[model samples]
Target: MAATPEGYMSGFGNDFETEALPGALPVGQNSPQRCAYGLYAEQLSGSPFTAPRGLNERSWLYRLRPSVRHTGRFDKVDLPHWKSAPCIVEHDRPIGQYRWSPVPIPDASLTFVAGVRTMTTAGDVNTQTGMSTHLYFVTASMFDDYFYNADGELLIAPQQGALAFVTEFGRIGIAPGEICVIPRGVKFRVELVAGAARGYMCENYGAKFTLPNRGPIGANCLANARDFKTPVAAFEDREATSRMTVKWCGKFYACEIGHSPLDVVAWHGNYAPYKYDLRAFSPIGAILFDHPDPSIFSVLTAPSGEEGTANVDFVIFPERWQVAEHSFRPPWYHMNIMSEFMGLIYGQYDAKPQGFTPGAMSLHNCMLPHGPDAQAFARASQARLEPEKLTKTLAFMFETRFPQRLTDYAATLETLQEDYADCWAGLEKRFNGKP
Candidate 1:
């Protein structure tokens, strides 16, 4: 981990090195390879609902991965000089069923999930759950504050616009469709430049995310480590009164802290701020047989407890081939320890059809029972199982270990689609009474 400049320590905090995946994909292999199958096809057309591609187009063909984004103009905004309200609040009024309502962070201790919802319908609400996945989103402003999740890492996904992330180590900008991972306690903030922004924020309160044991898939499959990029050491020696937002025992609070939060004079561990573009993801598949499980596409993961358990897993189902003959082509229904909080950047999520849209979110708590709706299941069942190409759409998840509890703000937002809860209403029970 890189160290923060001299005096920035107390506010910025220290970051540890994340345990590298047991086997990381070699760097600079088949980089920027392009095909008509997944994200590439969508990028080629310049669509907002498309995924971000690696620095090059031919990302998949290369043996190693390429840099996800080319460095751009990164600005350092002096937060102390700007005027703002005291960064703290606790609300009691109920809003609606939308996640991004402006509610005061509750004063009473509570584990509430906070963040912006891009898209959703009733049956599927993407609840941020990685670790104790507590998410936050900023619109048209810079998040010049500090946050802590007790004992978990931070998973940040930006759905729209760009974030000029000014940590102690220089500045890195994450545009749409990009994910930034800040390890536990590493204080940072977001400065939005494009437009209104929203996405997932998971505050993992368990073991950090590590690559799942490939087991039968050998040590190599999805998410090669070298593909992950950590910013070079960048330090800031400025003095200012920045805000700090801490989530402790389920409640959000603010303190009148006066210092930059990206302070880690010097440290070494496996945790750091790394970004990944979904387009660079090399999808492993059961080409001639059937669609493999989503685990096969996990680019980064913060595991929870033991093996097969995850506090949060950042998984994507980008544009890819559908060549499974004589098999159901969409996601199958199953319950898992990790609750799933999903969102779409652009295009359709293969698992659902009509109601799901770009900027929509859905949450399927652990064991709550979820999958393709009845309409999707029926259509996919009768459709031809040919090698159909699914392109343009890019959807992802912030899967977590805890069952997410909706904040009053999210339970009552004006934009909250009231009829969405009925998405699964048409599902049928076909069990015969013969047992």
Candidate 2:
């Protein structure tokens, strides 16, 4: 028996219970008692990570099982049109078909967001997808696998708990406030490493993100490439019953097996798990003149197929100085290749006037035309623009090619602050006589 290490014991002291469905789909029998760490060790040591192909065995650690009743909920909507062209899941076929469709969306041209469901059939399978800018919030404990886009870009932000992210590239124990970006197609798993981890998942289904165009601002302004760190080559192999779930084409399924699915013996690629501490972001802005477009603060961006068109742009406006002499403090009205879905990790966003709180998200479809609310515009226009640091606020935006649709669960979620729509109401417009 392997005894728990003294220091590491704290990490495992949480409420990690197991659901012993001895013979669930793919692998029919429950696997031997092994935590995610044990499985990682076995892979590091050279053992098959799956059950002997023919043997049927399975098990899952569903951390988010019981917390469905406590948290706030989204106001549900009805979006029947999305049922047909839903996304696809090509992994684990035997388990059965899966269903994923956005509950309802305000606009059809923007996005499609939905909860995920899956069943099992065969071996140790992990379903993965390269999704767009729609952030995911799992209402239930998702027994599944994860992967990055084809290029191996992984940027996952969890709202509630932590996840044991295992991959052929490397492994990371992540929680809220921290995010992981695995370049497209780097095989990985989403194991609930801690307590009921109910959180949001944002898939930027946009063009590959690149540095913001320097334009006249010159070089080394926004996001520096050196801040990005991709994982080096890593592999795992072990023979045991492990379940692999895959989400493809919009459905979820599973495959049974008797080996570790994270088996990448010797692979080399630029795509891998890399993260940038938002706090480390270098925020550059106008210290003397009017505030520039938020594009000046973009960290990474995925452009659309069209020139200068962005599929998704991961931009952040962290704590920074505000000293524009005759400028509007908040983000100015604008439209571009991207549809913006904004979230506040913590602190106030300069763009909106009010009601946009932490964890609250708002979407402005491409070309929809939006900007600072009335109250904010009035305040900034009247107040003296002295140099002052707007500290302790970290807001982010998922500017994508397609508009995002909210899940039925998300839209109808009682926790969905009904007052959000009223924020824009405060933005009073003043037309000049010249017009």
Candidate 3:
């Protein structure tokens, strides 16, 4: 809410307090009987009230008008391409590894919500137990329209251009190598900062994403708390006709509103949107021998009800040094219980060095063996083990415990590489009885 737009408060999940106006935020109290500056006090809860202290999340907002006044009678709207979980569409393609070239940014205008093309989904949205992977091709910004998702929180990784998210909390600007997460039920509008924007989005329907535990690796070396930025208080106070859309229960509903919903003048709480730059992540790898499991590269993990297993893990392969000695390097062949939907943000992914371009995507479902392409395998096996830096490359994955099912739109997209499996075709059998 500060006059300095896009300013952020540092730290992850800290009870941040900010105000656009002096004394707008109450002192020593969350809600006062009489609010200051004639603003209304509202509570935004991200978790159940009785949830554990560490897990509970809630925010108190001082706004020009209460949120209830921001909407009218709702009507159903159609966003055909934005599919949700439990959306198993019939397809002819068999189960195996799949990859796609960049989904082209269309000439026609498309906003963030309008351009969402769901590629894969897992678990059930109704039960809030799964996630969805989507590619967004944004050509235009939302002017007088705003949207909020009731089904799940959104994690966005931009690959092509830049975006400015004006939310109820504040503004977060992200570019090709960064990500932002908008919490469930947070009203926000996406504005294109560059000509056109392309990105990968993950809709997490389970628990909110949290920094993964380091365990034996000790207290630091991954995503430090200070690097996860939450925007300061900022809001819009315009009076004009606007439309608000809600994605609830995997369906779309729209309502007419008299004014913009981004009117929070001040707020104090941990339940808000935040962003992270992939460049800041401190990656740890095997130094003496073989590489660690990909889980070692996890940036954030949304845990399931079970212990240890994750509902969704946001992992990244960023610019780093590869120095393992006598190791196969570049990810070794293996099958995972979790499904992986990976995308490149900027540079070449070391695994599929040939076709996995920036803005491209690859999907490997549960128990499906996948690893470096034939060329990558041959090159890594022959190259000398030294401290080599993988510069300017940023790739990421939305790995989930549930199997990812392809949407009809994705299954038949022309960009989907039909011969994706051929990347491994050149692998020669190297088994030797003498060895």
Candidate 4:
């Protein structure tokens, strides 16, 4: 089938229906006694059967073969770099603010799945209560290899290059400044469209990432629901010796298969992969004076079932106006209960104007004091109070309620800025009792 322009269907969480072949999908029923085109009917569920109707997520698929035909005897495999949670590797690294330069892409051949290097993990994967942050450096595409994670869904943020995700639902192409999410337990393979690709990935082990409730800001701004694009029904019917890998409970298992698993001719569901452009995000901040909390810039939030707390909040700081009168433009120095892992996509972040470059990252654990560096603070404190625009900057945070544990690979990376704390050294004590 030919690729569609924009190659996607719009809207988020809307039940969608698509069929590559005419009269392929069964009408009036999810499955029929006899299928059209001699295809098998299968159901994929993203939530429990007893879930509330509003939260229920399931999909019906008409494919060349049922998913049961996509596997054989399972054999354990090793993907050393892809670590999961409850993964606290003992190291000499201290518990404090840390920063790292852009990690160089590996020279050896690495596919999307094989290239995943876990930088930090929070909560526990076994209990399905936390998330893992990873950096992927892909140099090769999966030709006959396919993979799926039964543990959790993946939220991918591309910082460099583009990727074509060939999945059971359809094909989705994503590039830098864009994000794609693959639902848990969906079989897919990644093809590098830019020769090589580098990106950040968040594996959510709790609830799925959904649009945050816009109470006073209303529904029109901050990631409109219509902007999220889910791919239309498309599939490949190729017969060849193939391998399928499964990541379950932090362990990897491989199985042999004779054909591609992405053979779905038709599908109708709310549970599907989707992509969004980060530039489309509508930001709202303080209009008069004083800077609002970064929560106002949240693009999506995965709640931890507790009020005012998030399992993980995917927040971004994009290009916007700085017009707060008599205020410190950059973020202020304060300790937060929520742990933060920040990354730069392009341009400079106002908070750390010096060392934080694109593809670089910093971590501040729970209750850790962090804010504008010495230079950023001095400039913002003394600069004129006229209207200013922060152009060409895109920074984001993976803010979580759980403290993140550093992976051994992350702690040992040559890019780790050991002197990250020195940024606060220049803060002169201006305290005086006589006010």
Candidate 5:
């Protein structure tokens, strides 16, 4: 796909090289004392210097100015609805299972950063573990402003409208059913592509999101690396006053700059922003008898240092075939160790078919018993055994090992469905103990 100043290269975490102008990049070494275009050489590290080669992520940038000039005296900024973790007692409401209707966009104009409303937060932001879920209702773009979150990387999922992300690396255009991830400390601005946009952002404070291991399933299917699109180098040398907002240690700080932070004329690195089309995800599922675990649908996972236990797992349930004979095609009723924050991009989710409309969200914390509501259970139980196709649906989940605590804004939102648990009321005792 095309972008404002550059195009995209296909790969996930590859050491890519790009230059907006010829010979802007270094010939051999990363830093050659003097850059080709009279630019400054800088290194951006996403991981530690001693990190393993596979895990090490750093980029060399040739910019018009060093990043040292991109800041001023930071002042505290208040983002009332943007919350972080460790403050568990946001409200006194009892939490069993919760769901919300589509949140209405506000009447007041809101920029991308101002539009963020935290729904749930897990783990500790200061400790750099766990993640948070946010609903963004954007009425305006960040004009003459940029934002970078030192707390975590942002995984954006557009549910309603399109968005154009102009980052230090390059520009990315994403629409519904497409997702893009901006690294933790990358400076970027958001612009509305098709008017006001609404989306979900999973702020991952743990390890950066990476493709899950296929293991026994082998390496061929499910979110192939070749499908990921990373933008090429692009920049502007124009001078203008701008505002920079930094989210560090659960607080916001504002900085003033004289020029765009995205003035990287050329870059070579494996640490940059990338986008992926959810439609291109090759899903692997239960082929014959039983319903497979939701891990099969994981598109990306941020590990929490434990084997097979992720700080956050980005899972999607897209259009696919249901052919499991002698089994409940919908998800079975069972409590899980991991907390789940779910959202519907479009169409009907197979579990909670009604009330869970597009842009709606639900939360089932760790060990919370939740599955198909009575309607879905009954429908799947009585349906024919023939293979059926589920079309035009895209539902996703941010499953985490840590329990997600509801934020005050989310706990008392007008969109919160007070009687969401009532959907399971119709699930009468169907067990007569008959073999």
Candidate 6:
């Protein structure tokens, strides 16, 4: 297979070293009294100083100036559309299973930051234990504007065009079907690569996302570590006016600067941005006679401290086979405690085949009764018992332990599918009570 054009260092959670300039990184010791090339040494810690060695995450950066000098005084700015958790906005709408068509790209200019529209929020941003789902419609790039979220890490899944993420560590290019994670407090700017870009984002305010344990599967399949790519060291040595933005506690703040913040000439650590291709995901499903739980399809999970429970799980429904004999292959009907917010990147999801279009989203909050719609249930029940391939389809779920509250913007959207319940209306009372 051809390497990604942007290039990447393989492996997950491995201490990687990259330098834009040769001999720029110091040997052995992380910090020397006087750094080479008059660079400033700074440590960026993703975890606490006393965190266990296995969970510790920190990186050493050799940059033009310390990060403290990159910002001035901060002034609070309002982003009405982008909201955070514990946000139970009062609305007339009832809480039930709901779906919406793809939000249209704005006709006016909207940068990545300005384009973020939060649909639902779970947990609390201040407590840092939940997540939020957002849709970004980027028509303009952030030329001199840089941003970092102090409250959470971002998992971006593009559905329209490509994006070039120029970060303090390096640059990562992502398109539809590929996802990139920017760790908390990593300054970066989004640049549009394939014109305007539209995508879904999961802002996790809990533990960082990690590959799930393979258990009895023995780690040979599902999301392999080698497929997760962290970018090579890249930086800019330019002098120009720039603005740095900070998103903390659900509020936005900006500071003016004289140079780009992405000035790191070299960096080494496991705490950095990385991207993964969904197509590279090796999916495991029912090969015999029963449908497994969706947890079996999880690509990454952010734990909630409790064992087996996730603060959030990023689960994908990628192309796979269906060979369960005398079984209803589509997901069975049930109410779940975990709130599920699902999105389709492309093709038809077997569960809700008709109304769930690409770029569309649905929310099935805690204990909400939902499953395969009438059309899907009918088809799966009558299909022949043979190996079938579900191709060209990709869907994902951002399921959380906490209940998600819809934002006012989401509830008021014109594209909201008011008739979403109709998909299940045809599921007749077929229980004959005669086994």
lDDT of 6 at 348: 88
Q: What is the C-alpha lDDT of each candidate?
A: 0.50, 0.47, 0.92, 0.92, 0.92, 0.91
TM-score of candidate 1 against the unseen true structure: 0.65
Off by over 4 Å in 4: 1-6, 432-435
Which digits, one per residue and each the tens of the lDDT, describe model 4 over residues 1-435? Answer: 432333689998999999988999999998999989999999999999999998999999999999999988999999999988889899999899999999989899999999999999999888888899999999999998999999899999989999999989888899989999999999999998967899899999988889999988875888899999999888888889999999999999999899899999999989999999999999888889999999999998888879879999999999999899999989989898898989999999988988999999999999989999989988998999999999999999998999999999999999999989999899998789888
Q: After superposition, how far is residue 385 of candidate 5 from its true place, in Å?
A: 0.9
lDDT of 4 at 28: 95
Residue-by-residue lDDT tens digits, candidate 5, 5-111: 64899999899999888999999899998788699999999999999999999999898889888879999999988999875873878968999999988888999
User: Which sections of candidate 1 miss by over 4 Å?
Assistant: 1-130, 133-135, 143-151, 240-269, 425-435
Query: lDDT tens string, model 2, 46-125?
Result: 11247353221111221111112111232233332222112333433221111222222122122112332111111111
Query: What's the lDDT for residue 51 in model 4?
Result: 95
Error of 3 at 252 (Å): 0.6
Q: Model 4 has how many clashing residue pairs? A: 0
Candidate 3 weakest ten by summed lDDT: 1-10
Each prediction's TM-score against the native?
0.65, 0.64, 0.98, 0.98, 0.98, 0.98
Model 6 lDDT, residue 379, Cα: 87
Candidate 3 local lDDT, 1-435, one digit each (tens): 222469988999999999988999999998889888999999999999999999999999999999899878999999999998899777898898999998888888999999999999999999999999999999999999999999999999998899999999999999988899999999999999969988999999999999988899999888999999999888788888999999999999999998889999999999999999888999999888898898988999999999889999999998888888888888889997999999998878888888888889999999999999999999999999989999988899999999999999899999999989999999989888785
Judging by TM-score, tell me the better candidate of 1 and 6.
6
Q: Tell me how candidate 6 scores on lDDT.
A: 0.91
Residue-level lDDT of model 6, residues 7-86, one tens digit each, is 58998999999887788899979999888889999999999999999999999999998999888899898878888887
Tens digits of per-residue lDDT for model 1, 244-359: 55544333455544455554222232334566666776777877776677888787665544567665677888888888878888888877666677777778877678677766
